[model samples]
Target chain A: MEVKKSFEEINEKIKNGTAVVVTAEEIIDIVKEKGLDEATSHVDVVTTATFSPMCSSGAFLNFGHADPPIRMTKVLLNNVPAHAGLAAVDAYIGATETSFDRDIEYGGAHVICDLIAGKKIHLQATSPGTDCYPRKKIDTYITKDSINEAYLFNPRNCYQNYDAAINTSGRTLYTYMGVLQPNMANINYSTSGELSPLLNDPYLRTIGMGTKIFLAGAPGYVAWQGTQFITEVERGNNGVPTTSAATLAVIGDLKQMSCDYIQPAVFEKYGTSMFVGIGIPIPVLDKDMLMNLAVENKDIYTNIVDYSVGRRSKPSLGKVNYAQLRSGMVTLEGKQIPTTPLSSLSKARAIAQELKRWILTDKFTLQEPFKHFNKVSKLNTLEEVGKGEIDNE
Target chain B: MSKKAYKQRIYIEAEKCVECGACTAVCGAKALRLDKTTWKLIYNVQKCQGCMLCVSACPSRAIKSDIEDLPSAVAAAL
Candidate 1:
């Protein structure tokens, strides 16, 4: 396919309300009817979206100093613990962080959600009285507006693809994948299939640092390669990984986020996590980029993993396409297992539609990446080295 | 009466439930309640009429009808 318009030309069309924009769902059918050449010629942008429970998510808040300005070393928000390792007024509250009072239900995710929901949260802190900052004890009520700076700087948010979990043990297992029934009675899979962020960017060609994104109702950017990024994972012909591959570290202003997009979730046995609604618009730069956006449920696949094993590399029962997984049943070892998704597809589609509306109405604009991510960056695994082994290396 | 004469009731899987209170809102018999102290959903088996409303209402698929000697497929999985 020949490239007709440059990125600048597309941006000009976008600004002038002349560019044709379609969602990932819409483009699939468009590409099917009209070949890649025609699709790329007509469509200038594709909006991809996903709403998943990302555990490695948190918010950095700079709660403005109190009357006496205490150097807070320990902080609690609505009885949920917040990491006070930052400066005196700044604290980072992790999504999976649990409270000492109610460990399972109420957590840092809940606190963040409550703040987004416009609820007042109790803030408590304790610190040793120092010379510069004397006040040690602090007790106050704070809301999202009251905080000076509240932004979500998640180390990892969107995963390329993930594993479907099943329990092989005789007893039921409570895990982050939800309740995995014993003997593989039920399987829990979490992914928006074609709408997943990294899946749309497959080879990481367009999505990189400084890429504009719809982050929980507000605009955000791709900060860096997310933690535990395994870019060398095996891929299919479509360049989409069949297993867990790349991830995106995202940063957004939490104050601009709404309660609808950024929700706090509590997994039964897995503790607390947050459901982040993210939408990324991919510019149809070339035929390759267009083809990556054309990936469908049939083309994407993931492993049905046996979560009974306690290691990171759990044994895979077999690989199943998202088409089979979305059908609500997949045969594993000749046994039909019922599948459930922790992520909501309806919400994902809504986010995509919302982003599409934003782009069309000139409320949001696409951005060219300042620098692309390193595709050859290797993810290292932890290993126990022998005494003096580090010196030898 | 024989010991087997008692009818089977609804079972709430505590581990599977996220305590969203969806089941409690849909229960016509008032058989389910969320415990405030522990934040766990409590199932009153006696009040449960085996309506199975809570089973269908549960978002996480945590509630199930516990019928003994039933068909394996129905009893085994949701």
Candidate 2:
């Protein structure tokens, strides 16, 4: 019997600047164990965003951290199952376990397109009424004649048309939005308009899942306005230091977009099939919105929290806050890679039978006779040459 | 036959309880417990619902709630 958070209701919602949401089963158990397909595959990318039958048999994927980034990564890879390799998983679940009822407004992109098109579709967006608006033509196009005219002019099409498309897209429609500080230090942002290189470019390079992703119950807010184009690179400095001009345009754009991690040839080109992990879903921060953003922007810095997870980003081993988040199983380690395991229920039937045998294996050919793990072989190429089949080979 | 009488008040605070288990991993009213031998933070106060998130995560502020201590703990639950 315990519960609290009252310093005058956390200083009147951070002195009325408002913006804190997170719920939907705390963003589907932190994207079923922190997202980006659990950081480049190993199953458990599952998401319905919130309550459903979801406890495995997963494949929901909805996410809309305030849409319009190539239509939110093409409606999260066109509602799953493209090329069927799997790993759609991103239906908006970055932070929540408390602090909701932000006046119960709704329609985070039509409740993520009616929870990935299970219904409704009155889709409308023409926006251009000034300040940073770029959703020109979508006056009604989630096809099939707008979901049969949005279920024949509303046969109780609930979630209230995502609150009428967030009141005609004035845009503060967030339901479980993420990253409360994610600027793993490579900041640079000077441009003015037309944004969305994945949400107003802070030097985009955010590939997803399984590298620890969880942030429960509000509190995560790290949008540090591109940490004022970072400069501080003095610890180790293996390279990239031609006497600052923003570290020579951030080390000539991280040596033409290489963003670290290629050593041992990317673990000898996927030996052990390249597995990385990160699972963070620790949000319980409306301590009066971090004490009114640390008393009005603690000298206005804003790197928007990236608190490093693994594989040497300034070589970390801290910052996994919310009083050290917990609640049944979560592991991640590096170098010799021992810790792994992030999704549970006893490692989900041996990681879904090793991702269904690494999707019907092809084990880089050794020219015949190698079919081990329970049979699979039918390789042919003779061109019907009756007589000496392999003689002309 | 229903009357408006459902007061609130359910709290805990065994010295800023650090037996982490995140308020019993989000207790929808499993009625909080983390006493694996004197970790000290058990409860059954009629399966509480004043949900203050263990008093906004008591890093040692300890928990609190007292809506007149819920009609004498619901009159010792009937």
Candidate 3:
């Protein structure tokens, strides 16, 4: 691989307002029309994005010490429980934490989004008072302006690839993938295909730790590799993973976020989750990078797993590419199944365009990763000692 | 059915609908369907039986009946 244009050169072009930025979807047409040589020389960066429900998302908030500061042992914001083991007035609210008062409709994700929308939230905490800070209980209302620090620290988001789900059983299945009709009447798949971040940078060449990204409406950074991240997966011919692959642990300032990008949602029989907007700019440092960005939905494939199975490794019916999945229908076992996307492509495209604007306006700049992620990780299954035989040898 | 006669219609808020097809899946009637070409939700009010399954099945709460909304008030006024 040859470096056609360096990051410094791209940054200089961006600063001079001369950089030619295109989205991952837009780059395909450019490459197809002008060839790789022309596309490589003309484009500076390709923006990729995804807006979907990410379950492993939450924020670590530090509420400024109150008068007669009490160490918060149990923290509840808007009746949703938050992890308070960190420190006094500091807690972590997970997105999927359901509200104790409002049942499954409202959750920690709602609380976070409401706070972003400048809504007042009831804050209550109980503690064992100490001599230094002697306050047992307190009740008060707080807004985003009153908080000291609110930063989203998501553990697993921007999944490199994912599987479409269908129900093979006789009963309807309500899952994180959304509701699936029994006997494979409907298919629910996620991930903004062709426009997803990791899919655009399959080899992790440009994206890594410390890379700046569009987190909801605010700028964020990739903190580390996310949970259940497995790099070694069966990939397609285009070097993109065919099944679930890499993930990202991203962090950003929640104060600068907006409700338009970060939304709260509830799955019907399941639980609460969050819909977050994420965008990443992949620098076209070389022709290979341009070629990767040139990859289209037809080139990316994912397995359709049976959600009716209540197990980690569900049975995969068959492989279907995104082009077919996006077509709203796919045939399996000689039956036509109506398919719908869980991730919003229109919103994803908007985020990509917004990130592109930020770069063009000099409001944001791309950063080279300080370190790349390891490509050898396996998701091991936890087995009960008595229920299943242990396989850790 | 006369033109002036009030008929119930299902309305889906575009902003709230993610088009996950859950409503179509739960709809026992053939009223709610996803366009095979565009993957968009298409609701047929005539085929609906006032079951309100989609309205309840919608996780985003984006669906509603026109007869139960402002349309009902208009019908009463007329």
Q: Pick the candidate with the highest lDDT.
A: 3
True contacts kept of each: 0.00, 0.00, 0.33
DockQ of each: 0.05, 0.02, 0.33
Model 3 residue A349 CA deviation (Å) reads 1.3
- For model 3, the stretches where C-alpha displacement exceeds 4 angstroms are A1-3, A386-393, B1-9, B18-49, B65-78
The TM-score leader among the candidates is 3
Instruction: List the candidates' TM-scores in order.
Output: 0.84, 0.22, 0.92
Could you tell me the interface RMSD of model 1? 11.2
> lDDT per residue, candidate 2, A1-393, as tens digits?
122333244235334533132321223344345542331222211111110001101112322213442132222122221111222213221110111232112212223223233444333323232344334333333422222111100011001000000011222211111111122211111110010011111111121111111111111111121111233322111221111111000001111111011000011111111011111111122222221111110111111122232222222222221111111121222211011001111111222222222222311100111121111122233365666555744
* lDDT by residue for model 3 (A1-393), tens: 444887788888888889999999999999999999888988999999998999899999988899989999999999999999988889999999999888778998888888888899999999989997799998999988998999999999999989999999999888888888788888888988999999998989998999999999999999999898888999988899999999999999999997767788788888888889999999999888888999999999999999888987899999999999988679999999888777877678788999999999854778999999998657886766864666647
Task: Locate the minimum summed-lDDT window of 10 residues in model 1 chain A.
Answer: A338-347
lDDT of 1 at A340: 64
Is candidate 1 or 2 superior in TM-score? 1
Cα lDDT listed for each candidate: 0.80, 0.22, 0.86
Candidate 1, residue B7: the lDDT equals 36
